[model samples]
Target: MDIEIFPYRVLGSDTTEALLNDLESLEDVKRTVIHGPRFPKGEATLPPKYRERRVININGEDVVLQVKTARIFLEITMESTIDEIEEICKEHIPYGFDINQDRSNYIRKQQTVTDRIKYGDKELPDELVGMTDQYSTFDDHVKIIKKDD
Candidate 1:
């Protein structure tokens, strides 16, 4: 059993409210919270002042635009695998949006490599390695050749 955190940001408040309402209707979404610097328990936080403030020229007058930032926090339980979790999230969330997994010990381990073979280093023995059927030698190493017509 593994726990995964999914973060989503909806630009407008209307969209955020709609998404939250949809999630609340689902039983699988156990808990949802807004995250922000001011309110740690909230589901989302206001956009930073720097980002919210913008200057634009409108009709010979300078207009300042303030944009609000908000995000939703979903704590999901993964019984199958990370790929399965991502699929579920994609199915629920809309297109052109971003979804990211929260930082965890498992992710850290997978991302950080303790030992890496540098250029010109001796390749590991084949007996100690496992071949993956999904990959092809030709796909792994592609050569650019000119065609002589």
Candidate 2:
């Protein structure tokens, strides 16, 4: 099951960071993909505090956010988790947000023609099937955060 968190306005780095931390804490929220316009690469046009690509701590790992956080796609374990996710969004997205449950598949589970072109015949792991845009290299976009004992 999957749910899409669509905020009325683009979310900043701090909101994205806090929202991700909260959502990821839920066991039912299996996987997440944050989608938005890519931040421009170069000297910071905005002040340091307003920068969009700032590094954020998810769990314990610090990962740099590359997108402006227009929409957040969460893959959950069951349909019941939708309400729980809604509550979380209610608290985080004050400007207004929608919990879209209608989308049958927010996260892609199958490989496409683009995937074939990017990866050839080499098999890809299930978790990485649609985590990235075909135009971008996998390493540049995908960051798998694993905890250490």
- Winning model by lDDT: 2
* Total backbone collisions, model 2: 0
Clashing pairs in 2: none
Model 2 alpha-carbon drift over 4 Å, by segment: 147-149
TM-score to true structure, per model: 0.33, 0.90
Alpha-carbon RMSD of each model: 20.4, 1.9
Candidate 1, residue 78: how far the Cα is off, in Å: 3.5
What is each predicted model's overall lDDT from 0 to 1? 0.37, 0.85
Clashes of each: 7, 0
Candidate 2, 1-149: lDDT as tens digits: 87889999999999999999988888777788999999987638778875778789999888888889999998887988888788888899988998887978989899988778888888988887886567787878988765333
Question: How much is the lDDT of residue 36 in candidate 2?
Answer: 94
Per-residue lDDT for 1-149 in model 1, tens only?
A: 22433345534433334444454444444344443332233323555542433333322334332223244444445533445445554655555444555444212222112212221234533221221122344223222221123
Candidate 1's C-alpha runs over 4 A off are 1-10, 36-69, 79-95, 105-149
